[model samples]
Target: MKNILITGASRGIGRATALLAADRGWSVAINYASDAAAARSAAREVEARGSRALTVQGDVTDEAAVAAMFDTALDGLGGLDGVVVNAGVVAPSLPLAEMSLERLQRVFDINVLGSYLTAREAARRMSTDRGGRGGAMVVVSSAAARLGSPNEYVDYAGAKAALDAMTIGLSKELGPRGIRVNAVRPGLIETDIHASGGQPDRAARLGAATPLGRAGSADEVAESIVWLLSDAAAYANGAILDITGGR
Candidate 1:
């Protein structure tokens, strides 16, 4: 069976992607920074779909933890066919000038550095030059990356923007090696992330602003992620897909 590792799989978009991928016959390594209970619950769902599942605990911002997570996943799954760098964070809405250095550091640490660590490890393990099979990587970016959440969370936006650049550059760098790198930019999705940003109802309030006139669900975004990881997207490297309902 094809194996995939997904960071932040305990809930939200990460959880949704794990469940969907498992349903489609992929062995999943569910990675969570904390809340082992939630991670195990996600693993149970994957196993219920008749797929192998492993629950791994690691803080993506910690280089050693990320390396260990990858090692555990590789050993448990036998091999990895894909990785989803989906773990991220956002502080309460605030202007750039008013934002504390610590807040910015925390955001960038998890969203930017964390993604770099996971993607780097995945490349190391999945690259043909490393004597392993090539695989796909799907990064969960945000529409805020392009919109530039002006007064809200510019730090979060900047972090995600960095991820976009990484997706483009890494896709080209790894294409010849048979690895595909892509990103999905989700907008106003109904997830707990907004609550972390101190706006639990942000999605509902902004739903009408989008052309589709509604906020997206975690499952909706998951579908796009799974497709990008599938053979159907064979020629979809370096693509930055928007799941924003035309926002």
Candidate 2:
């Protein structure tokens, strides 16, 4: 069976993707930062879907922890056929001039740095030259990477922008070595992330402005991610797919 590792798989788009992956008969490794209970709960759901499940805990910002996380997944799942780079965070709304140093560091450390570390680990393990079978990687970026999020979250926007660039470069670099790298930029989506960002209703408030006139769901974004990780997208590399509602 195909095996996949998804960071931040306890909830949001990550959880949705895990369920879909299970439906496809792929074994799932659900990675969580500190939510052991939640991760186990997600693991139960994956098992219920008739697919094997594994739960791994690691704070993506810690280098050693990230390595251990992958090692655990590798051991538990046998091998990884795909990886979903989805762990990230954002702070309360603030203009760039008013944002605190701590906020910026936290944003970039968990978002940009964590993403690079996760993708890097996946690359090392999944590269054909590294004694691994070829695989696929789906990075979760944000529409803010382009829209800039303006006065509210320019720091977050900037961090995600870095991911966008990384996804592009890694796709080309890894394609020849075996992995297909692609990214999804999700627009206004309903998730606890907005509440954590101190704007619980951000999606509903801004989604009406999109050409689709509605906010997207985590499931919607998950569909695209799972598809890209499947053979259906075998020819897709260095592709940055936008899940935005035409915002």
Per-residue lDDT of model 2, residues 1-247, tens digit only = 6899999999999999999999999999999999899999989999999999999999999999999999999999999999999999999999999998899999999999999999999999999999889899999999999999988999999999999999999998999999999999999999889999999999999998999998999999999999999999999999999999888
Evaluated at residue 148, the lDDT of candidate 2 is 97
TM value for model 1: 0.99
User: What's the C-alpha lDDT at position 217 in model 2?
Assistant: 96
* Candidate 2 RMSD computed on C-alpha atoms after optimal superposition onto the true structure: 0.7
| Candidate 1 collision pairs | none
Task: Tell me the lDDT of candidate 2.
Answer: 0.95
Alpha carbon deviation, residue 174, candidate 2 (Å): 0.3
Instruction: Name the runs in model 1 displaced over 4 angstroms.
Output: none
- Tens digits of per-residue lDDT for model 1 on 44-72? 99999999999999999999999999999
